[model samples]
Target: MVPAPGPRTGARPRRRAGGRGRGRLADGHAAVLQERPCWGSLEDDALFALFRKTEPKVQEIAPGHDPLGDLGPRGQCRIQGLDDDRVQWQVEFAVHQLDGLRGQDDGRWPNEFLSPAMVPLGGGLNGMVSENRAWVALPPSCLGRPGEFDGPTVVDASVGNKDVELGGERGERDRTALARAVVRVANGTLRQLGCKDSLADPGKLPPVSRTTPTQMDALCGIKGLKAPDAERESLRRTRVTSGQGGPVRTCDLTHSGRPWSTSVRFMTVEDPQLAKIFSMAAMTGGPRIKGTKGYGTLTPSRAVYERTCRTGRAVFLVEQRQSDRGYTLPRELLPAYAESEAGRLGCGPVEMKMPAGS
Candidate 1:
């Protein structure tokens, strides 16, 4: 594919116009498709064929621009029933530059979507990180529900730090097929942008169930964490989940239910770029975790710790939850959590101690 003119310079005009097709569904939903060639010949017969292969017709919408200047250019479409044309799902496609231009440096894709915070789609092939980009397919309904294996609900493919994400709420029956189509589109988008094809082929994805609640004692075992008060004792619990056997991990503490409340959230990030972003946030101010080879800062709302592990650089975070609290933030909790997580990664010991009562 030839390189197109940059957004700074005038972008090339629309090369072709797609048919404004409409669809109607039995659910009494109707939709209109507005298609404008956002990327010249990149929209080929194969792409059109993929759209037609689905039962519901895809109504293409005009390309969209990001006012925030983070996502450079975008296009969107929605699926609707052929007869009634009621909208059932929406899909988005976008591309950004890699050199941090147009706010590409933001870590939304790398930090949240591609991190362990989100569960893998299936077979672990749908989620991966390479030197150039991080690609993952996630369940759009809820990351907390690991058992939901309809298909790849969300596909995020970022190359050289820039990203192209296809997200939508899809029906259970058609999800797997639609997800493969999205993968093909995403791969095509990457090629059009002159990036390598980093996304793998979406083969038969199996029903995946990875994330699970960790034992409550996971946090209570921390040296400095105080026992929950009698009134809130039963309410205190810990839930843990991680990426599909990847380096990303999360630990959340919450009140069981007596007025559902959140205490603190801990995360370990192995993505190099994301680690850098958190490292920058933690170094701006706040006290460091004593005896740790890494750096950390504690704020009223959160704490961030960065250190090198056996694999590479990693960042750990401890954040206060917005929900009603049932426990206090012990000073030693940060280091204790960090040490425990580091050990899980086979990192050397981190002897941490808070200075005498502040």
Candidate 2:
């Protein structure tokens, strides 16, 4: 049977002399319990117990795979369920501390997880954030499929200033199932921690529609940015998602079923220190985009720019590789893309200037 983490609201599981438990040992020799205290006032131990009741079949699936371990901020713990010695499903959980409200914006969680490849999980991403904390659920990278993204697998819920990220992986089921499961755990954790902002009912969450890149404005969530007919020549499918109708947007494009080749992401960095870093990079790291409020730097791999929007400082990134045969390169479309998005975001006009010939 899968070992329980501990009794709800009670003592944490203890580690034996040479076994897995709350503290770590020195190479199986020393018994000095080196345990990192769980930061923040939230009761994470109680929150984990909810996992036992939240998903009962886990023990039945992989009785040998214990899901108990303490790795918050210092490490992570994973639970796996297998069928005939093969991993059928798995869940990984970890917590990270936030620096004095750093990355405390509404888009913090989404922006951290949003990527060019996070588009195929069907329903996109579901999440909620408040003044003190945040939480999000989305697809996790498949274990068997290696390098492919599919199952909506992870939930990142913050308690106080620390982030509690939980990821789920499934072999045969669809993304929605995992999404629901993770969301349940996330919501349960929030309630256990007495967090005020709980996510909406997971059952009501809708699946994302796989559509062609026909509507530019809708695809990227930026108004007036029309899709270029030529750009669609290589497009096979695209997933566009907005988390809880927030300003953060993600658009990933791919030709094959998995491993999206091209991606467009926009996020507003609310933390002043974070924004200042981007601003400094815009001024010193590379040549300034002529018509925008930020700077532009292009390598063979990715093209990115940052601008000052009415909301604060915003970042726009277009990552693509020529081998992917996905979308046009940095020089071909990034300038126009940045301009359109900047305008929609209520930022000043920007013009990108490529360095001297070639």
Candidate 3:
């Protein structure tokens, strides 16, 4: 992006967001590319303008999280509670070429919920193995709310790149074909989710997740899911009872015949069974078991219990997008589905990794 011999000829090329190459807005030329932040409570455009006008007290290159694979620039903006306070937006830009048009847009998105509660999302633009010349932009975060991304879901978005080649009709047809193909892919994918008000002001939650489902993703009747034979983990059984002694065990698999350190200790009780205990139990407390760190209900969640009780044919649901031991879960659980009852839940059911009948 060197200036062609003039007063601004010494202009240095700025490194693009992806570090793929370089770019520079020509001296004295106003930028026509448009982009806005989506994850915060305030309007990003105006906030960003005010942000740059004021200097940030803390401005440093934030390092990426190696354990989580989230390298800093996630487009999460934190605007301080002051008038002159700036917003730190973890924004990433996508740079590409299209005929005479070039712009930049990346999807480091925002959320209605905090981390851990926020459904995970991600994608990549691998130039090496893409197999197609047309590069499509995918959002880096889920557009749905806290519980929205829990079920099978689909994700899609696109934007213009920032490098417009002025060369004469070079690869115009090829580029045109690529653009059309990208549009087709986007249309096909979105259409599968039925009609949605994508252009409407998506405020805090998504325009799509307008309705929440009743049958949420919850833990089902306890079933054994085993690890790989190579792991050599053995199954064990022990007697357990509720506070006042209700048969909390579902056969030998009240929790799992095959051991699994689940985030929470879960058991599905029939409404009839729960109804009896309903009269005997206290106003606001579940059975408590005292033990070491490996105690009962490793991670207790009342929300998980409510969802489980509401559904039939017990399914061990994982509200999170993915499991810690990926190999223990099924591949179908990772995909995005349209907004069905299961889809709206944002997460999928966990298929016990153990033998089918075990």
Better of 1 and 3 by lDDT: 1
Candidate topping lDDT: 1
- Per-residue lDDT over 1-358 for candidate 3, one digit per residue giving the tens place of the 0 to 100 score: 1001111334332321211222223442212113222221123233333232222121111111124321111111212212223333222212211110111110111101101111111122211000112223222242232121121121222212222222234333323332333333333333322324222111121011111111122212122233233222211222222121111211111123221222222222222212122221111233422222101111222211112223321122112222333332221221111112222233233212211210
Off by over 4 Å in 3: 1-90, 93-116, 119-198, 204-358
Model 3 root mean square deviation, Cα atoms: 22.0
Q: Model 1, 156-258: lDDT tens per residue?
A: 3322222222223332223354344455555544444454544565444333222233344445345443433442443356645433454356655565521
Residue 73 of model 1, lDDT score: 34
Score every model by TM-score.
0.58, 0.50, 0.20
**Which model, 1 or 2, shows the larger TM-score?**
1
Clashing residue pairs in all predictions, respectively, total: 14, 13, 21
Error of 2 at 192 (Å): 10
**Model 2 C-alpha lDDT per residue in residues 34-148, reported as the tens digit of each score:** 3311121113233233222121112111011123522111122343433333554344433222222222221333343443222222233344322112235322121122111
